[model samples]
Target: MISINNLTFNIGARALYDEANWHIKPGEKIGLIGANGTGKTTLLRLIVGDYTPSSGSISKAKDLKIGYLNQDLLSYQSDKSIVRVAMEAFARQNQLHTEIEEILEKLETEYSDELITRLTDRQQEFEQLDGYNIEYRAHEILAGLGFSEEDQKRQLNTFSGGWRMRVMLAKILLQQPDILLLDEPTNHLDLPSIKWLETYLGNFEGAVVIVSHDRWFLDRVIKKTVESRKGKLTPYAGNYTFYLEEKGIRETIQRGEFKNQQAKIKQEERLIERFRAKASKAKMAQSRIKMLEKMDRVDDVDDDNPEVNFSFRFTKQSGRHVVNIEHLNKSYPGVPILHQADGIIEKGDKIALIGANGRGKSTLLKIIAGTETFDGKVEAGHNVTMTFFSQHQLEALTLENTILEELQSFAPTYSETNLRSLLGSFLFTGDDVFKKIKVLSGGEKSRVALAKALTADANFLILDEPTNHLDIQSVNILIQALQQYEGTFIIVSHDRYFLDNIANRIWFIEEQKIKDYPGTYQEYEVWNSKRVIPKPAPIPVKQEEKAKKEEPRPVMQNAAQQLKKLNDELSRTEREVETLEKQVKEIETELADEQVYSEPARLTAANKRYQEAKAALDLAQQRWEELAAGIMEIEEK
Candidate 1:
């Protein structure tokens, strides 16, 4: 457990936090949430002691072990195989096991009672530490992070940057520290892997503090939210969705009170000034002014929720069909990625495509966007304007240009004043406008790419994981803006809450096939529930047919006769319901009697029992109806 007190951090006169306090308790799962550049990540660094606070004290238990996973991963280029590196987390256990082996060998050679006792104690300690299951635990953690069994033997250097980041995550999980601090843990995870991590974190025994932009992931795992914004940290006792609703209600009340106090302050100031100018009332006015000076002013904090304001002024209206794909098949070397795929993008339709990572979701987007080609038909509509943001969309930006210049280059006719205004709306402020794209952070670079994309006025937009680097607050802004945009969109994202709230339809991509559901993602989940059950047969076969043929036989007749035995069971349930209903009616009759009202305790007890009996009767009636309906529906035919 840890607590931060009176933490004030300032760099070059810009204060990130002033007297901010944050607390972490054992076994607590918390989400650090805020808009981009609001100091969420900075607070994480401060907690892990990665960055010392400018002032104030961070009090933590002396022996508390903390594991902090920074965004810029330390490059894991080494001779050790991936499996060995993953197993390194169990180094201490392995060492203890080796010592136990040596002690056993020595015990066999020398007979010393004291030495034997010490070795016995050490063995018990090793067993208590779970030294035996270390390797198995490591393997389980590593595999959950998307590492294939075969890839375990391969060196870590062979993996790409994203895969290496997963390996780093695996290492942190394997460490089994007391407190785990993860920053952008979902950044490198595919959809399946993200879901896996969510379940894993939900059941994690240790305390976890995660900072991520994925709202759906947070909603599933975190039960509490810690919002770091505007030099303050506010803790809410619920998940992401619950926290949003609570924060909205709280801000509305706070803003209202703040406005009223401000108006009162102004009125008091005017009256005090007017009375001070009058000659005779000077003494009373001076006392009132002193009271005003001593009174605390309620500082007004607005509902500073970020707005998206997507102004995509298109150059021309797209054709009816924005894109069409037919019999698309592609392969590289020996593996077939997409097989005989067909899809279409209609004008003004917002479509969401979801699939696992490393699959052909991005590849399909490329084929449709014409950034890459396929073996089959991919047609772009006539006179259609198109803009695409790839998963690695930042690669498209011209790093040499300033943020303002970047937007201006796309829309040359627009003045610098208008360009700055546009950039400012996306959180690119005065000094940020002058910074070259080369020096911008990943989130900043994304804003730059987004600004240029909107300025082009493309009627069709293809966004691949656009919420990757954004925070929760910024993501909502993007969602509102996209919802208001008047154009067709084909987006691929793993954020289920976002898809549920914004997408009109979902295209579930799996097994080289796409299933289109004409509803929100939440509805899709409900529809998926039916697909889980085995469908009922049109008619009973096998045993029923054999029974039908042998109906006249005595043995078949015997089976039918046995049905009369179960009739007693059905009758018993029906009778139970009738008995309970009679009991409720008796209770009502007793309540109508004057003597029953004289005993308050008896009346209360009878009412409780009556309620219970009524519930039992309702359930028994439902069950009886279901059994009777099934028997009648099958036999009446």
Candidate 2:
């Protein structure tokens, strides 16, 4: 357990935290949230003792172990295999194993009772630590985090920064520390890995403090929400959604109180002004002034949520079809990414290209943008002015140019006022727009790139991981802008909440082919979950049916009896399928309820039931289809 009391931290003259107090209890899953530059990450560092506070103290229980995962770990390199790196978490067990091996080697040469006793003690301690299966546990965690068996055996230094970060995550998870401090942990994770982490953290026993922009993950994992604003930490009893609702209510009450206080102050000031001119009321007026001076003034609530009010206007409308891919065959030397894949992006289509990592989402995006090479045809429709945004574009920004200048240079035809307004929506306001691009942080550069992309006024947009460095507020701004824009866009992102809100269709690559799910992300999830049943293969001809063709057909009475038996079986399967279908629907309905989604235990239980029911329903439906075909064949005979 950790208790932060009167935590005052400052960076030079800027105070990041002022008397902000928070108590992280055991087994509590806390979501630390706020806008960018609000000190959420800084608070975590203060708790971890990575940064010293200006005053006050961060106290922890004696000998408490903490695991902290951050972007900095991306730079970590090791020559050891990933599994070995993760297994390093079991320090004592590994040491004991080595000592036991040494003893065994010595016993091979010479026997000693003392050595035997030491070996026995070491083995017992190793068993107590579960050291024998440490490697297996490491492999299991690595696989869950998206590493294949071969990948687990590869040297950690060979993997990219993202994959290395995953290895670091695996190591931390294997440690099982008393508390977990994760900052933007989902940034490097794909949808599947993120979900796996969600399940892992749900069952984690220690306290967890997560600072993530991933709303969906927070909603599913966090039990409490803490907001860092104006150098203060405010706690909410529930998760992110509850935090939003509760914050809104609190702000409304604060506004009302502020309004009433202003009214009272005005009434008293007017009375003081009128009475000051009279000799009899002069003393009374002075007393009233003293009372007004002593009264505590209520501060007005700040608007943390900024909405996009700027309109995106394009000069020309795009053709009915935005993009058309024909026989898209793309692959590397050994890996088959896509072969004979095809998809169409139409006008007004908001598509979310999503899947696990290394599934060719980014490659497909580049293909559509006409940037990457391929052995297929990708045609853009008539009058399709396009703009593509990616992480690489951030580096393309002119370092000397100011944020406002960057947008202006990109959109020379647009008015400066319009460009500034767009930048403001991206959280670069007034003087902030005057800052040089080189001085901005990665997140700020991302915002500038996004703003410039929007100013292009293109009818077709291709964006890859646009929300990578953005905070929750910045993401909301982009979502609002997209919601207002009438352009067709295909985006690849791991942020499910953003995709669910903006995308009308889902595209995923599977089996070396492009696939489309013509529905929202939520609907696609439900359909995809039950889509486990593979297409039925050609029904094998039964021996009786094969003999029947050469021999004669069965007698009329026998055929009738067989048909009745099939009909009875069909009816029973139909009833079972109906019941299972109803059960799935009921579980889905429960999942849709906010109350259930807000509770991690309830959500996990409901999802488990839903999966079970869906599997049953698929089996029953498959059986029914087989029976129906048999019935139809008999009738034809």
lDDT of each: 0.74, 0.85
> Residue-wise lDDT of candidate 2 within 82-108, one digit each (tens)?
899998899998999788767766665
- For model 1, what is the C-alpha lDDT against the true structure? 0.74
lDDT of 1 by residue, 1-637 (tens): 8999999988669889999998899989999888777787888888877788889989998899887787777465766767677777776777776776675555555645665566557656766877655655666676777665555666776666666777778878888888889998888777668877998888888899988888888889898999888898899999988998998898778788889988887887888888888899888788878888898876676656746544557768888998888888874443345678777878877888876555567777787788776688888887788888864678978899888878887888777876776676677778889899999887789877876776776888888887776666566767887888788888888887777767887886544555588888888877865442211111111111221111111222332443463466679888888898898799878866666544444544554565466556665776677567645543443
- What residue pairs clash in candidate 2, if any at all? none
Minimum summed lDDT over a 10-residue window in model 1 is located at 535-544
- Model 2, CA-based lDDT: 0.85
Model 1: CA > 4 A from native: 97-127, 391-393, 413-418, 529-637
RMSD of 1: 18.0
